[model samples]
Target: MSIDTAPEPGRTHDVRSADTDPDAGAVAFRPAFRAALDATAAAGVRVHEPGTEAYRRLSGTFNITKAVRPLAVVEPTTPDEVATVLRLAAVHGVQVAVAGTGHGATEQMDDAVLVHTCAFDELVVHPHERWARIGAGVRWDAVLEACAPHGLAGLCGSSTDVGVVGFLTGGGVGPVVRSAGLSSDSVRAFDVVTGDGVVRRASATENPELFWGLRGGKGSLGIVTAVEIDLLPIAQVLGGAIWFDGADLPAVLRTWSQWSSLLPDEGTTSVAIMRLPDMSGVPPVLAGRTTLCVRFAWTGDPEVGEEMIRAIRCVAAPLVDLVGPLPYRQLGAVHADPSDPMPVHEASTLLAAFDLDAADELVALAGDASGTPLVMVEVRQLGGALRTGPDCAFAHRDAAYQLFSIGIMVPEVAQGVVAATSRVHDGLRPWSRAGGLPNFCDQAGAERVRRAYPRGVEDRLARAARRYDPAGVLLAGRGLRTAADAVG
Candidate 1:
């Protein structure tokens, strides 16, 4: 098929073995493989083998704990380059892992070829068309910066540093999620390379099934080269957060839960019980103490937004109140997510109910006097446009809320952090549902993912995996498949 001028990978080759997996032993690159990679036809692709300084630098992942040394790291700039890597992987029966900017990496790609997409740095904004085309390498910050002048922005998650493709493909849940729905719903089209070296365009009118599967299926189908997504037209949002003392946790959490349950779709809200470190950038008042923070983002009139937010503010005396008008480009201020990478262990579950009783339990599980090692435990109200949004692979729209917990993975508290995460989820098990959001369950294995998708979504993903990635070239594709029915 005729397509856009993308790329061809593996113009040069440096071969060595990482042997990160002890059981797998050493891996070798054939002379034929080296020659293919060095061919003049493979003009623009770059390959870095293990044991080199460049490979070590490029292979480092954002999550420090889940690190792996793959056999080779392939950096591709275009669709043809991505296709070439996948084609060669399939032919040589080598496993491949698609590491797009590496934020959401879950698996250790042992003896596999790592396809890193940092070079797919293409971003083109079509202001009149109300959409932007971004490469897999692009981050939400770049998109927000490019679109801010035009009064347009994509529905990005709490952290703008996250890669666009990984977030959208996993069905993004943003600060404005309740108002705007999942970020994947806004995707217009995708330029992806399937496992068999086929470059395809997936949209509503072309390869519709693939389009549906790609929206919330992560990389179960293929590696995305570029994507087009609808951008919202507006300048500012009533976005910011309020913090309350931890001593008032039970009352504050319960009050916010009741008030937020009645919140309108125009407003998106989440509350977090945080224990901030007494370090730089930490507010003096909240430092070394537990605090409850309520983040609010209102897309409608600022006056009405203030009216809705006033209820939570009045529940308790705020240690700090930062709720007010904010530019769409500054939406990340609402969540105040840490900009730098850290070792973090996280867990999430959909809640069937989050009433006054559940709120009390949550406070006990992760509140001030609980002696919990968790850094933050949050609950996000979900409803309105989220339940009514265009459907694809995401399930559990009827869920009333979502429970998430994060713990920093420093050595002294790493074990405690993991334990605390399990405790929080186990304590809240009564109100919890079975499946987890794709974006939340980063380390979930195939069987766990199988259960994570209810309503036959798992079966559909497995079938799509077989169809697009028959040779099991992509690790995520192999994830959705069961052991009984093996792919090539």
Candidate 2:
């Protein structure tokens, strides 16, 4: 959240000082400033400074490589406290960054106050209303566990460990996206603290413009404290994964590319070629070798679902076949996403299509004997209900598929991991779309902004950013400034 200088091109700064009026006078985090933040803690908040365990823990992020160290971290229990922090940052001319569970953290916050929403860990399910009101700090796992007993489902991505607010704000695409639509589509309302030190509620009828912007704008306009999300009545789904030996990759990829293109809206699917590490959480059968996994989730009748998946299972003798009727609460099993915090380099591209030629190129670049350093390469089937969501700031509804790659940044192969990711992606350039989802991609910059949103959409997001965050005191995260030159 450093604000001493304007953000350099392609670099992400968590916050920018509102006092950009060249004559506003330079500000620093002097002793009196530290004392003021500490004093505000008297009203249900705590300020932790550097070198302390609390500060380190609160300032940490899932991707260790992008870990940020702010001058101080503050945990506020109420939205008022959130407003107080923003107001003080505005007056004192300090920058502010927001953190929620640290899973989507993208860059360094060098020297500023980080507003961590850890203290807003509230969750209340209204069984009769068929919705849940959750705080920013709550993760999908908690929401899933809480709603399961009542036979309800909260749309969540492969990893339930990610924070609910962060996921929704970034236009959430989950395991059953084709059937359920984007996760952000389920949000009913939000309680937020704007950069002007005001608390506001946004919904379809209230602050309608802000509601549209907040859905896919990330933390640009405001820091969301809580949200009311509509839940699905789905109790279980026909879902899970089938794994095959990497030797069968070529056949598997070709079959998947053709099959996924024909999948109905009632069915959602994705395929991943994995090179699992031999670690505590890894199964011996999947460890230290390449494997191909076909994940599917069906929202319709079970018998038809099984019949639909038979085509994939028939492609090869599976190393592991776990696809079956599954409780919606256990959906994370489909992708088996990592739960631990670690360093990772990620990249993604949306595709106009994933035809046979695209499949062939992928196999040639990352086949079993290709000597690739990437840990995983995934292709998710997009479209169906995903393309029909209501008007909102979310973009790229016309993309037919999404290719995402992840490389663990272990020191020995960090450089190789990044390079190989590019090689594979560049090799498949023929079918590649020019943009990406804001939620995906390794780096945050102008390129990512252009990649995530079209000119018309980002223009609206930029306008909303300027309107809601007039002084630019909030973190213009996910390329807020790149779209709007008025921002710092």
Error of 1 at 8 (Å): 28
In order, the Cα lDDT scores of the candidates are 0.82, 0.84
Clashing pairs in 1: 7-81, 9-45, 10-45
- After superposition, the stretches of candidate 2 with alpha carbons farther than 4 Å from their true spots are 1-44, 486-488
Compared with the true structure, what per-residue lDDT tens digits does model 2 show for residues 379-415?
Answer: 9999999998878888998889999988999989999
Looking at model 2, the pairs that clash are: 1-109
After superposition, which runs of candidate 1 have C-alpha atoms over 4 Å from their true positions? 1-25, 29-44, 483-488
Q: What is the per-residue lDDT of model 1 for residues 198-290, given as tens digits with 9 covering 90 to 100?
A: 999999999888898898888878999899999999679998999999988899899888888899899999999999999999989999999
TM-score, each model?
Answer: 0.91, 0.91
